[model samples]
Target chain A: MNPLPALAAAASEKATQSGPTLAVSDLRISAKRDRKSVELLRGVSFHVASGETLALVGESGCGKSITSLAVMGLLAPGLSMSGEVALTDAGGRIDLVALSAAERRKLCGRRLGMIFQEPMTSLNPMQRVGDQIAETLTTHGICSRQEAARRAVAMLDRMGIADPGRRALALPHELSGGMRQRVMIAMAMIGEPDLLIADEPTTALDVTVQAQILELIRDLSRERGMATLFISHDLAVVADIADRVAVMYAGEIVETGPIDQVLDAPLHPYTIGLIASRPALSTERRARLSAIFGAVPEPGRRPQGCAFHPRCSLAKPGLCDVGDVPLKRFDGRDVRCLRVGERVQA
Target chain B: MSIANVTSTSDRAPEKVPDARWLGLLKGLWRHRLGRAGCIVLAVLVLVAAGADWLAPHDPTEIYYDYILVAPDSRFWFGTDELGRDIFSRVLFGARVSLQVVAAAVALSLVIGAAVGLISGYAGAWIDNGLMRVMDGLMAFPALVLALAIVAVLGPDLLNAMIAIAVVNTPGFARLVRGETLVVRELDYVQAARAMGASPLRIVARHVWPSVSGNVLVYGSLKASAALITESALSFLGLGVQPPTPSWGYMLATGMQYTQAWWMSIFPGLAIFLTVLGLNLIGDAARDVIDPRTQR
Candidate 1:
């Protein structure tokens, strides 16, 4: 019998007592179209401790966003999800998967808050930005509308918007892109949620604004002791704000560890490729950024042994394509690759 | 997170006066010549209608038998009718009846239809299908025929005529608002509202309603003119306001029988034409002003 399951079970038992703010285990999501079925997410699992940010990194269509949405109970209709999603709320561990739709909705924007990808579209154009932020607080009955409105302005000021009182009165279109993102952050953070899900919050902003938004997220998470599940395709951005990183491929997490360790000495070939693909300031002029050879395989078409095997440089033909390859513990991190033992020896 | 960070990059954009959307629409309407003309004509019509008691030279019901069928002359600017009553005074009183029916009918349809559309569109699947199918059924019949049937069943009177017009127009408003709601419901802000745990009712009221209101306002103005035409048609058919009320359509009906007395038909006919023209112009201008695609 593999000892990994036993070890993980023991750890999770302790996790339930008082550790991670959010813990998702063996989550599987599948979709049905007529007689055919497709697995969108396969046994995805991760945990985020209080005051720590766990970045789920992957290219587009690799289910990074899906994992976050699943955690938040915001998956689209026609998709089915199963397995345990344990959320630690006010010293109690509630299995979110067991909650009804209305019960789940009550927890959202109260115990948990999410910031979407598009800042421009995430806000109601007709409403004042301050009212939008205040809505989060009033929605959960945390405070009266009048009190919520005042706190919303204070939150906006904390987000670094100048003349926040007047700015609060400004509609979504009146604010700049960066300011809009700050407002989004303020909206998500206003409830003072225990778990914050930021799904590529800075992807639409300018580079300078991107850095500032990342800093704001980090500082706020630290200040509030909030556990953040940060989803991003950008490795550089993940390295900047995330304490830990999980690299996903074809709907499954392939490698996960401390951010520095994953970036500097990646174990999985996919992680290695991801870190290598980032454009660096030191690269020679005209040199093309290295990228993973092929796109992430569609759910139903993924290869047998490992989803990344077809694009992996270190993949051996017969072994890598033979059968299911399980995630194994390796050097204080988890990695899913057949040749990790050989790579480590070398 | 410091207070100093707030001032460091504040005021990047120039601090100009905040502009309201409706103010922009008003400015746009004023800039267009036809819109300005429509505004003036409608303003005068409303004033005349409101002050009909004071404005008319003679009492609408009072008879002046000595000057029967007189042409447009010094005493009667619009001439006298078959009853020997001043046509000018009758037409002024007719404005009051016409404006009252049109305003009440349009307001009823706008309120009821907009509410139905909003609820149906936001709550998709069976509710949407069921509500929309009912609206479609209502719209299937010709608007005039439907209004006539309603008036016939409800008993012919000014109130019954207004109700018939409102019922006929409800389908149009419902269909328009439903379409707008379907589009607005899928927008990201709405999804953001859902993510924030907003109740369905709150989302519909606060988010969905505001986005579709501009289109509703434009459509309502356009429908208001149609309601006026319907009200006039009902009165002309003798199924509307009873005699002594001085409705434009009733006056037109009475005047048509006396072909030799040209002043009788011409004055009432001119009132109907001018009011309809003013309303149509205002509707057209409102559509252009509210429609973002047409903005200069």
Candidate 2:
């Protein structure tokens, strides 16, 4: 190993756990597409408290994106959703799902901010960068227009955009990809939103910009005391920024624990396979990276028992593939496997 | 990393030339020969229409009974109509009427059509269907027949002619805008605006409107060209402007009686042709530049 992963794993483990969790429980979403009502998420649950980063990692189509959207109340119309996404406020913890969209959107205004995968298109191309930031501020009634413009420049200045005053006047199409991503981050975090959901925020940037942006997010989380649900497919990224990590497969969280515990001593076979699949340092020249056997199944056709059993190495003939496998305790964390102990011991 | 950590050479590049916006639009037009020619022709027509009062040698409606059926000469240029009105002066003033009819009808239709389109597109399945069906009913009629019916009910007057053409043009705008709105409303920036506590009105005004502007400009010019031709037809049918007004269509009607003079009908007819041709060229050029999918 090159030692970065080991170093990152240790740092994430050392990060402390804090107050009340952003507490998601029993979330379900189904949508009617192609004349079929597919259950996209099945009783998915996890939490991230203020001052904590929970990395929700999984492959494409594994319900990680759906879960974050549900938390933010941004699921597309015609989808059926049922779940409790509770966040603590001065009024006390309230379930976001129980509220109307307009009502939930009110909470989203001052409290929630989300950054998505493509920053290039997230800001309107016709709008000036300063005005775009000022719009969010003015729309929320946070400040006067003049003040918003001034603050926008200051915010851009802080975001490391040189000569923020001039840059603010330029249209979004005038900016580069990484510069636009920085603009997006400034817009999302400008009001110091309480719950920051970053769904693969750095996935589109170059490697160096990715590192810088990730560092910026981590720094923001630390300074703002905001609860963050960092969703990603990149394990190395999760190892660096996440305090806790949850591995999702087939609409359910199959494994979760402290980053060091989950990544170093993973109890679930899928998690083991995922970490093993990384192209890491090895003396064996041109060695092939390990990969999980099969792709994640489409929503409606998910197999019985453990969702990963078909691709899992430690799957037993009857116990692992016969029925639903509920999450159970192992190694001071949760793992959804009946043969986790048997497989690990062997 | 703060200011000094920013190395311009290593950062992402923005592929653009920093041209002033209005200048950029003009430059783009200049690059296309068809667009430039269309703009020049249209500009000359507008200038003539605006300056007709000062430029014309004779009053468009001034009667010269002695010059009735007279041929083109130094005394009565473009000859004289059977009513003894100067055909050249009438043709010059007719530019004003053509521009007014097209401009008013296009403006009215764009506002009404865009509003209907945006609301219908945003209203979802059943509501959208209901609004679109009503528009479809309007569209089902042969355009000229429907315009004639509207003009007949409103009476054969100038304002009524503009209104009739506007009503005829509304359905086209509504359909274009609605189709565009359906795609634009789903853009990420629009959704992001919604996430920021922006009401439906704000999102539509800020995000949706701007994206569809290029479509609106191209289609508006196209509809304006059609409306000018429709106005001439309505006037020719004696259902537009009125008899005394020096409209090109009315001029054409008078010109028919003095076909021997030829200049009476020919000049006005030529004026109408060139005006419509200019508008059409402008529309084609705008569509080519604005609608990316149609570009070569």
Candidate 3:
């Protein structure tokens, strides 16, 4: 009664519509062979608002890449997906999952652009870098071929490439790995898509190039007010760029919160383990970086109850491992832990 | 934007830069003197094939009874075959038939084999197994034996022999491009194409085909050489270029019986040997030039 009502009203006024630019709901991906099916992603969901960067952070096999692929509708052959992905804009919203492959393709590289982890092999080696970027523009009917070329050169220049006009004529192989990655970014962002999905974009690069690439992505996203669904396994890198973070474990997002709160005060055991594992100034010199014990379970072999139970230090034998622990909110943050700022009723 | 230590690379010489790279690939080929020699041999063969009619000193089939089996006299150069046909003239004209047969075999294998390779490698699984099995079955028999059997069935003639040789060699090309495509299809660039919203057809045409074509063409050249040798074997067996056409193999077959007429067999055998050698050299050189892994 003191000030809560006024704060709530201000929140509503600040965001007249709290809806997201892209919403992915309850995505489940599996592969089937001979009557046996193995789940890759289990009911993963998240929303990305305009001008917000939401990072999906997980170790390998935690289904981060699969989720990104599912969102892009580029899941490899033999994998099947069931979900809903809505892309919203000023023109209104369209269900990405409901669209036919042809329609989804039309939206891809136009409304939704994506960059991959391997900058080394992400571009066609035979095509000139400028032509490759122009191809994306021409395919989307974004501009005339000549206009596309001019824009491609301009985009390269904006990426801080020296002699952008001459560099545009170079092949992917002729360029350094960092330069090639910049070319890839130009190709993806030239469309100025509403949503940009960068799946571990800097994983293949060295540390310095990594920072440069991250800065480029951050600047470009801010300039375009583009929403991003960034996927990575590196918690330190994620901390540097992501505004909000969703930590996944064994095909499910186990925790989610704003970056500051999540990094400063992690709720789920897994998130705590991730933040602890990052090498920091305060970390003891000889002490090993803390790591979550054991491994993410293979699909079809995920432990029952809390998928993270096998290695979770706070796991209550009878409760945490008894059944699937669905994500729920506590203290205005999402978590899947059995005990997180909660008292046992018994 | 600092690019960090990525600078100073220009003086270091990048690992992948092809030396003397130019659109014509002339510098690359000329780097190896043997390859240049091979190119010269092929050029000469083409000129001889094209001008066979004007180059022959006499009608190839002319039975010069007056100079029957003479031993390399300038008056009747390369002596004469058992039928008194001008051995020199027949050898000259034989170049035309050899080149035509090789050309036809190469064309057939190039189209049919490349298409099969693309489908098998790209489609994969059962389609891959099924198409590859048919190729395996064809490859099971020794090329010459299979070509001979096919000639026996189609009723021996130059065209039948060429068709048989084409059939025999198609499997090699299919396997070559299929292996190449399997590697290419999994490359990240391929997935990038899909992410670019390229349709399956566009991805295949624009991405898959170009990367695979270079190796396929290289393999095609080697297969052409094999076809030429196989055609010679067929003609030697009376299954190709029926007599009086003056094919090198046919000339050698009859020339072998006349021990006193040494020039009878020597000239035709030299022609066949040189043509096959020329082809092998060109193919090997092309492979070296196009595949960076093989470059020095």
- Find the candidate with the highest lDDT and give its number: 1
Tens digit per residue, CA lDDT, model 2, B240-271: 88877789988887678756777878898898
Better of 2 and 3 by TM-score: 2
**Rank ordering of all candidates by lDDT, starting from the highest:** 1, 3, 2
**Candidate 1 docking quality: incorrect, acceptable, medium or high:** acceptable
Docking class of 2: acceptable
Residues A80-179, candidate 2, lDDT per residue (tens digit)? Answer: 9987888875557777889886787677657888887888888987788898888878887889999999999998887888889988887776677777
What digit string (tens of lDDT, one per residue) describes model 1 on residues A1-346?
1212333333334665447889999999998866688998999988887777889999898889988888888787779999889887676788999998789878878888889899989898767889999999888888999999999999989998889998898877777888889998888888788999999999998898899999899999888988889999998899888878899989899998777778889999999888898889999899999977877787788888888888988889999998988889887778998899998899
List lDDT for all candidates, in order: 0.85, 0.82, 0.83
DockQ of each two-chain model: 0.37, 0.35, 0.41
Report how far residue A230 has shifted in candidate 1, in Å: 0.3
Q: What's the C-alpha lDDT at position A285 in model 3?
A: 85
State which candidate, 1 or 2, has the greater DockQ.
1
Please report, as a residue range, the 10-residue window in candidate 1 chain B with the lowest summed lDDT. B1-10
Residues A1-346, model 3: lDDT tens digits: 0112233223223432755778888999999866889888999988887777889998898999999888888887789888888888788989987888899888888888899889888888778889888878887787899999999999999999988998888777678888988988898888888999999999988888888998899889878988888999898788788877899988999998777778888888898898888888887789898787898788888888888888988888899888778788875567988888564232
- Give per-residue CA lDDT, model 3, range B69-186, as digits (tens): 7777776688887878888888889999999999998999888888888889888989999999999999999999999999999998989988998899889888987888898888
Error of 1 at A39 (Å): 3.1
Runs with alpha carbons beyond 4 Å of true place in candidate 2? A1-21, A283-285, B1-23, B257-259, B291-296
Tell me the spans in candidate 1 whose CA falls farther than 4 Å from its real position. A1-14, A32-35, A299-305, A316-319, B1-19, B63-68
Model 1 clashing residue pairs (backbone): none
